[model samples]
Target: MSVVRAGGDGRTEADGTGRAGLRTLLRAADGVRIDVAYRPGPGGREGRGGPDVIVVAHGFTGDLDRPHIRRIAAGFARRAAVVTFTFRGHGRSGGRSTVGDREVLDLAAAVAWARSLGHRRVATVGFSMGGSVVLRHAALHGGGDPDTDAGRTARTRTDAVVSVSGPARWFYRGTAPMRRVHWLVTRPAGRVVGRYGLRTRIHDKDWDPVPLSPVQAVPLIAPTPLLIVHGDRDPYFPLDHPRMLATAGAGAADLWLEQGMGHAEHATTDALVARIGEWLEKRG
Candidate 1:
């Protein structure tokens, strides 16, 4: 589809399907260009009376074009406008991935762009690594202290937030999937595989001060309407992760321990995504 760029902020509709997609490039806190796709809900743009916007953040090794990612976007589009983007190292975005640390800036930029698009109510839905990023983004931007560069860029103002199959702590390698993930993020050969085989540009260094974990960030998201969905059969993280997040939120968070589900986008059904859309709609 051919997209017309009217200005740095103006979007060009590219999707001919009823769900019109406006493609744009947003700049992250570190000035990395992030590729963004905004799909108008059934109602269309806000000016034309469209529904609120829901930003969908993909997991590790996934991008805007990933089948699962697109499916999530499509599922949300049925209820509200959907914004999907490529994190710094994934798809057509610039810069390498710092895993979940600097990636918060990526989510921040996307949320800020969605707000700039005139959507008064903006909600974020993240999967796996993206799930962790959403939790941190809401905390950092929920009118709290701007401690880091990503925090400074996060003007959260998000109406609601969803975290799917995210880890509670950092440097966790208890599970086989997480162990393999650590190997991919820590070794040179693993980086090569990530860069070539997975098209995910991973960094060699480790977190200096170590960013806030998901459980730590959940409390700050209080009164912001948080939904934490994890699978009982998830191989990456056990039910404890979501339970801890829910506990941290006190009465502010909603936990959905999906039975028989796996992890992230692959395991999340389209019906579940649609249900999430409905939940966001009610929150708005």
Candidate 2:
């Protein structure tokens, strides 16, 4: 049974039966509505003490409804409560995609909501562009840093962060796939394709001051555990991306360079997702 209830702070709640989980609409700090879903851990329930929660952020053009996203959430639900959301411009969410920028607010709200549901520990697991957002979100809101804008409203710290197939820097066109992505993000014809073919609404402008890059942000996430996972054959970014992130993280991050992996959700196997869940459980 799915029922929607709108909250004052731009949150809309819903209750679904069994393992299907609860669904909601949360407002980003910037006013965009983010569509979210929450699945309880094994034997877990809301308003009761339960397993730690994992906020799963999807990649570019992917949403909560995507099969891989659902599969990943299901895998995590075995060990932890799972919260999955559609970033702005994707799926049922409102507003345009800023790619990785401004999506931090969406994540912050989701994290906040997860904590509000009475989960004591909240970890983040992000894929691709979402991976970069997880890194920056941890830096801005998880490390107890006072300088970041996200810190003002974030009531709970992100206990752990896992970045899968994320880029270390922004504006990268080093690879053919990346070059094509840049074209899709910048050109009018490409925007049309993104709108119809990909179902992603691309933002028109370029970065101004430029948001903090993943490598740059990873340093500030120290004291908070972090895991950086990348595929050896990732078409969007090479091994250098994870290496740069691991280097910036110094001793605080764990790097996993999968030998046979290719990229993002499509390439991630069920066994790999279960392993990631176990990793979160050990740290939780």
Instruction: State the C-alpha lDDT per candidate.
Output: 0.84, 0.85
Can you write out model 2's per-residue Cα lDDT over 126-186, one digit (the tens) per residue?
A: 9999999999998988644223335454454688899999999998999999999999999
Q: CA shift at 10, candidate 2, in angstroms?
A: 11
The TM-scores, one per candidate, come to: 0.90, 0.89
- For all candidates, the clash counts are 0, 0
Off by over 4 Å in 2: 1-20, 44-51, 144-156
lDDT of 2: 0.85
lDDT of 1 by residue, 142-230 (tens): 75322233544334556689999999988888899899999999999999999999999987888998999888999988788899999
Candidate 1 stretches with Cα past 4 Å from truth are 1-11, 16-19, 44-51, 144-155
Best by TM-score: 1
Model 2 residue 9 CA deviation (Å) reads: 12
